[model samples]
Target: MTPEFAYFLKVNVAFVLLYAFYRLFFYRDTFFKLRRTTLLAFFGVALLYPLMNIQDWIREQEPMVEVIQMYSAILPETTITPDNVPETDWHGLLLSGVSYLYWGGVLALLLRFLVQLSSILLLARKSKVMQIYDTRVHVLDRPAGPFSFFRLIFLHPGSHSDKEIDEILTHEGTHVSQWHSIDVIICELICIVCWVNPFVWLLKREVRHNLEYLADDTVLESGYDSRSYQYHLLGLSHTNKSATSLSNSFNMLHLKNRISMMNKKRSHGIGRAKYLIFIPIVGGLLIFSNIDAVARITDELVESSFAEALMPEAIQLPIQLFPAVNKEEPAEMHRGYVLSKEELAAIKRAEEQVFTVVEKMPEYPGGQKALLKYLASSVKYPESAMRNGVEGRVSCSFIVRKNGSITDAEVIRGVDPALNAEALRIINAMPEWSPGEQRGKAVNVKYTVPVSFRLANKHKASVSGTPAKGIDTSGRIFTVVERMPEFPGGQYSLLRYLSQKIKYPVIAQENGIQGRVSCSFVIGADGALSDVKVIRGVDPSLDAEAVRVIKSMPKWKPGVQNNMAVAVKYTVPVTFRLQ
Candidate 1:
């Protein structure tokens, strides 16, 4: 899952757990102020926790790998036919639809929130403004009860007695002083955006409920008679249909519970200890949220090590075994020798064991070059290994059976544990090879292959230019690194440079071909840019211009992985528009 979706899931899950715990343990308790603080704190932490990268902390404790590597782009093969055409990917479309729906919901809720604010503003303007004690109040012409929005309290003064109005003012004043309307507005907006989650609505209700309890407790503490204030609350709560949803209205909800809570005795200070549970709760969410990040880091480290081993200097394969076995029939037949029945039976028994040497050795469908191509294409450089700078040789042994099927693959010599696993995975995924032959008959053969993990080197030139010696331009380009390669100044400077330097192609401008051309390239460890290719093209002229401008860019600050500069792949969009 993407980090954004994971963040949403984590926040919702945290809210569910917190709200459930509050209802089960503390909702009925008379710790109103503490309860209010806890509710807000719960959501506040939830909002910020997902943004923290705890994976790095975990990575520091991990043992460091001893090797690092760099990589280059593998040139595309030009043997495409109609049968090799790609199929449409429905999973990408599904994900896009989900993203669109989520943003649509958010926008719709934001629009509703704006509409509610406008309505509240309109009501405030129509009502007459007056000073009641130290607070400025809006006396509504309609029958909406004693509600407070921010600092302004709205009430129908003519409908209540002077004493009742005094009590009502006290209630609304507590809301304004405590900024309970801020909590209401916050909850309203969160509930609107997260309308799909039931727990969010419950948490919203709990926030408002706790605020009311707090206000009621404050009035009782200030010497108001509980019985009289409760009576006033019941009388004023005539279900004002015109009451603003976004305001903290006096009789908003849970009248029975508020009255009961008013009569309950205050709990001991030890009740506050329950709030400490949030520490572990938050810790758990942080760990859970970073699980995918940890996996990604581990993968990078493995891939980095493997990429380094891909360099020619690191390849230590046993060349003696790799010499092509004589595939053609031997030039001369050897003299035949007679054997006893017992000797033939012993030879047959030993035939099950794999032979290291045969007249004709097993071969891949095409040749050794084709085998290397398959390995290069099939191997997925692990991101974790790249980040950790883990590089080494992973020697794997497999059996090429009489039926030309690969089997019994095992790692004989290992380097980094992650790289070893990845090497084994690639070997196991290989297609069938030609069977080895002995005495003109197919036989099982054991083969050992060593995959080197070495970091790629710095190149001194661009793709359409000559490179310095000793750089093998094989291996796929990497898209991520510890620190991404950047232009000398920064992103804004790079954008400015592109704006000034890039000119619209005349053919594109005349044909009205105005679209973004996405160009991908690899920045070598030496910071020289290479492999500039247009990944998504608008027109031939535009594509060529984008590639040309990319080629003209100066050396970038090379990308780093495992404290070593490595070849990193980057993509940029160059747009051509008609003026």
Candidate 2:
């Protein structure tokens, strides 16, 4: 399941559990049904507030999406693919199920404890009863009454005064009447569930304090001397026995606060205002805790921060805009391998027959040397090519017919469109060569020829270029340049689109355009290019050219690092010069 879905499920379960507890414990007082309803309504809102506004919360924390996405990608079930692809294993699904089970078990135990405590209270109510001893002390030994439920508050034996007994009755009575035991038990459960969240634990502690305040308010309202009641509370200082599911008889904790609160004077005039304050505070909390709001705030903050970090300290504009180059087309046809001896023999016979056919062709106007001479003179080196340098290799494939005629000559490799077209033109213009023969009979055969283009020392000298030696030229420069080949149309198709868009004449030449364009871009985990930037550009025009091209290109199958698609850096060159 998605992380968001999982989170939703978890929170809903928590809310259900909390509601069940509230119904079983806090909502027992049907006399003040409206108060109970109001409390329930507040809790209901609190529980759903986070979910209803989850989108805003996500937007607020924009970076969280990346973090969550990163996490989601690592999970196995997230691998949603086409029906043609293989399905993922069930291990991830099982693990998720197990996590849900564990949390469910915890919630079950909490409910069970609350039920047991309620059972105990019922038992106490049936079996025990409160007694007044000489009016100086009221003792309930194993109180049969629910009012003295789990408590054993000591009445001052020396103070036999009726006022003191009243104070004792009012204080202990407040604890029983308000069902403080239920609050204590519920608070313990809250601590258990939210043990990892410090804020939640703090809230549980506050709930306990509030329960005490609620009981104290009851005691004072019963028409007792609040000061003497405070002294009575101080004198009764024995610590209560800690019970997992029930409130203890005596609690020494918060004694000072309770006594101080009892003494504080409250004007009846402020009651209305105090109640009014709760409306806005609670409403605001509900709004602020809204998941969508929080998410939105987080998203904006993170996106702005991330964008700022990516910007370079120094401002440098790009020189030129390069059009997005389309990816290479798969080889339309691959020459099949000869697997058997018969196949090999047949191939050999064909080669011989074709060679014989080629041998008989007439020499061209400049012969073989003439074609080479033309290539040497026509190819111009660009300035950028001079700086970064350029070398070309040509591979040609041809079929020689039985009559010694060259047929279907194709430039298989190395030759660029302009160069390849020129080479094919010259080859096509030539007379047929002597064809090969098999068993003294001419047969068609195919052959491949590789031609290397190197910058000779003299050629470099003429162009005022320094020869670069020992550089591994094969695959390095060609692979980067040819990384993405033409789509439906050839390179010119892309070039034409870019020219119109950028309004710049982008020419491909052989000699003085000097420099390199390096761009850092994100190939999204999904393999879409985004946030392209020219890290270093020699000239503004060239830089802009590179960025424009990159931005226009279609999505890539992102590079893989450790079997995962990752963002990568690419550098391409655009060389321009005179031939």
The best candidate by TM-score is 1
> What are the Cα lDDT values of the candidates?
0.65, 0.44
Clashes of 2: 92
lDDT tens digits by residue: candidate 2, 1-579: 444554444444444544444444433232222333344453445445555533334333534434332332222211224566577758779878876876786687678767767765554455334466432223334322112333533433243366655555665566665666655565566545544444444445545555566566676777767777777666655523333335434344668877766566553443333334436644444444443333332222222111111111111111110111211221111121101111112234433533312222333244444533443444343334343434344455566666657777888664355445544665565566655555565667664434333333444455535222122212211112212222223223434444444322243222223333445565554446677776545456666766886788776544433333444443322321112
TM-score of each: 0.50, 0.36
lDDT by residue (1-579, candidate 1, tens digit) is 445776787778778887877778877777778788888887887787777875545433322110111111111111212445575757679989987897898889888888878988988888889987766889888666678888878888788888877777888789999888888887887787677789998898888888888888778878889999998888766757346678877876679989888878878889888878878878877765555444433322222222111111111111111101211111111000111111111122244766754557688889665776566556654656655555545667778889988887887666678878888887788888899899999998766675655433211121112222233244434555544576764443465566667777777767756654556888997789998887656679888877888899999977666556678777664545443
Q: Least accurate stretch of 10 residues (summed lDDT) in model 2?
A: 330-339
